[model samples]
Target chain A: MELWYTEKQTEYFGITAKIKETLVAEKTEFQDLAIIDTVEFGRMLVLDGMVMTTVKDEFVYHEMVAHPALYTHPNPKKVLVVGGGDGGVIREIMKHPEVEKAVLVDIDGKVIEYSKKFLPEIACELDNPRVEVIVNDGYMHIHDHKNEYDVIMVDSTEPVGPAVELFTKGFYQGIYDALKDDGIFVAQTDNPWFKADLIRNVNRDVREIFPVVRVYWANIPTYPSGLWTFTIGSKKYDPLAVDESTIPEINTKYYSPRIHKAAFALPKFVEELCK
Target chain B: MELWYTEKQTEYFGITAKIKETLVAEKTEFQDLAIIDTVEFGRMLVLDGMVMTTVKDEFVYHEMVAHPALYTHPNPKKVLVVGGGDGGVIREIMKHPEVEKAVLVDIDGKVIEYSKKFLPEIACELDNPRVEVIVNDGYMHIHDHKNEYDVIMVDSTEPVGPAVELFTKGFYQGIYDALKDDGIFVAQTDNPWFKADLIRNVNRDVREIFPVVRVYWANIPTYPSGLWTFTIGSKKYDPLAVDESTIPEINTKYYSPRIHKAAFALPKFVEELCK
Candidate 1:
């Protein structure tokens, strides 16, 4: 009489949630995808047995993924999101009035299709006039479109299955080539608790390619450790140098003027990992 | 066969970890106590089926609880810890050369005994000459002591079972009465994801008694949510006003000179709750 969904985050650790009903469960070209209604998190999206996003806490991930890069750029007109089939990142990217064009490249169309039906609020801006949705491999897209995007956001899942390539050094090199001269990019680098090595490697890899690299944090409860980290690689601008007073007010629940810089102040242990 | 321990954080959510062995499981006078050796988190102390601390991540929680208050005060010679039976806070407090004496009051003596046996690294300072361990009700201890301590820390578990009174307004008033005129105190205020009301209520209650009150955060993975909060109430000093250059260097893994000020910069949603 009871159904629960659990994501085995590691070999010995996992998180579980009581489910109300399973709306959809299928195998996409890239991975297994499912949409379920849960008691604590509302509608939940799971891919390859990992909780991707929940209605209650998706704002924290989407807002943090988009706002920091968008606000750091002086005039971000073109934005690109890689592997964000849920369209949550695109929705946040489209918030800036200066964004004349926003492109989202996701290999699996089923994730986009199911999200539109189940998570409309997060995928609302995917159909906007200024947005373009492309069903293609994000890795290849970055290689093909060289120096095209002003702000690039990698909204991929953990480094497993199709996402493995997304965490390599070559992918970061491709991201550097995919951005304009003054471009900035950020990638969700997982949590520091269990993924300390992944974050350290990503920080080192990005540091070699970008002049300014910063690691920031946010509290996303549905994630592996709840303390989620993001790595930003910029060509010229330092996210910390941006005068917060000049940043325009945007509708956000988690990201704010004070939080913009605060996020960059990494904890001592986390800062050591960045080194 | 596999053995796992799950802490049901809420009606719909929980976190599970594989257990290599159960070091101790006993029914104390107050609650159920267990020392589980986990595959991922090393030895973990569980009280009433909730994780109290783990060997791997205990540094983050203990450092944040003690360092901020100790460094903020001009010269804290006398300190008091309430309900910290594990003695992790006392270990961190003893690091301060200025502290001449540290008093620990807990409702249960079994926690202190087991911690001394199992989590020796965390409870190492429990037998220090300066630390006086007393198995007594923390609530009554605060009501008895008046203007006796320079810094007081309430290291109780979530406001449940025996700790329910520790979160009430009268307890905050008692803590205010138990501290010197220029004293400062802090308490673990739970997380914001599930316990927003608790954080809001504690902030309001402390604000009523102290001239200055602030909320800070740290990442503690074994707890319900990795994003843990701490509420600090000061009578004559603002924690934010402390000079980082003056807070002498200490041996720590999480708290740093820069992190002292950064932890106070909360996320937008969390700040909104404190308001």
Candidate 2:
């Protein structure tokens, strides 16, 4: 019997990948997740039946979602990462020398545990002293903490299920409340190609609270919409006005100081959202 | 009847798009190309059964390929575009105020004529007096010319078929010879995720001839690999050391002085190629 896996890009298109067997399958309290070894796309990671990351091209999503905000801030001291239970964001954030403390908040604990066990390189820094792993609702955490974090990076799955509320204006305002005046907020918005309306809506929502809001593009191969968008919201500095001279001297697989600034350069349609 | 359109990603994985009917189908001398209204990706341009650009998201590829090199040079007096028959590069190059002359060299004149007739908005600026249209081989043009251009942009098709030579060391050396001492050379390299080997090869080849070589990424939806890379080669100045104060004053859709400097930043995988 062939194991069937469906990849829903949006409502319009879906690719069904037939797998040999379920290498790892679990029904976590939050969602159904699995990591399957396949002939195509190499090793695949799916959460709640939604494709999250694949070994073939996980670098694009992982690097883009983590690097831009981490490298953009002047001095990222205390950082907060919400919904990235996979620990990829934590790995990238740890590359910065100034990041004294990092808090990983996700409603689902199983995702972190599974990722830590399987994807060792991505979750290498999870055991580091600087990290404080918290298994709880990220929304509540944001509301509870005020003016505490220098940077808030949201590495969500998608705008569906438990992650839907993260895209709302209320959650964005809560994020604004959680960050210091000079702090920066970066969230993985959906793909503009498949979800233009969502990208536009999220940009508008983020712009309402933050003085500087910009949408950047990253190409994640495993995603339904190949072209993905990340929206940056900041209170102090523009996302485009980053200092190139002060890049962190760390060995990173992705996320260089040069890329930090380039990531904010929007395409024509994405740039139109700012207008 | 279901009209089947297979977008050949590689020899292995080809995405089959179920279409209703052909909106516009024409066979040029080089390849069979068509513009079809599809159920999933909207109005899609299919060249040799591969999706080149779609109406939903062509800006990512067009803007990224055009903006970085155009904006980086302090003063772009003369610009030469290689293989951009679609006229998208011309549209972006015209945004620079200092660009007194813009030359386009495309082997397929039919592609230029068809794009001008079909996609007028993208090909609108082709008739500008400063824009010189040349129907010849881009490689030959570069080999013959020397120290004439401030910026040389290669917006070729994939590194296969007619474009295979464009990825060679000889071609890059020709581009280097064509550029002025302080001139910049930017070309669309392969996607980092799907075409890592190809990108590395191109990086290696370009680095041999040019003093400075760097690879930058862009999110293009229609391409085979969603994670696209652009390699830049310069003779004198590093792209990262661009002067922000000297940025050109132009109403651009994407490229800015801020982004010009940022495009030089590389991910670890790409930066490894430079070493």
Per-model CA lDDT versus the true structure: 0.93, 0.77
Clashing pairs in 1: none
- iRMS per model, in Å, is 1.1, 3.3
Give the per-residue lDDT of model 2 (tens digit) for A178-245. 99988889998887666778888888888899988878766566676566778889888776776776
> Which residue pairs of candidate 2 clash?
A258-B265, A259-B265
Estimate how well candidate 2 is docked, as a DockQ score.
Answer: 0.34
Instruction: List clash counts for every candidate, in order.
Output: 0, 2
lDDT of 2 by residue, B21-102 (tens): 6767888777776877667766676666767676556666777787777666777899999988878889888877689999
Question: Which of the CAPRI classes, incorrect, acceptable, medium or high, describes model 1?
Answer: medium
- Worst lDDT run of 10 residues, candidate 1 chain A, spans A246-255
lDDT of 2 at A75: 79
Please provide, for model 1 over B101-208, each residue's C-alpha lDDT reduced to its tens digit, 9 standing for 90 to 100: 999999999999999999999999999999999999999999999999999999998889899999999999999999999999999999998899999999998988
What digit string (tens of lDDT, one per residue) describes model 1 on residues A1-275? Answer: 99988888889999989999999999988899999999999999999999899999999999999999999999999999998889999988888989999999998999999999999998998899999999999999999999999999999988987899999999999999999999999999999889999999999999999999999998888998788999999999889999999887678888988888988877788988999
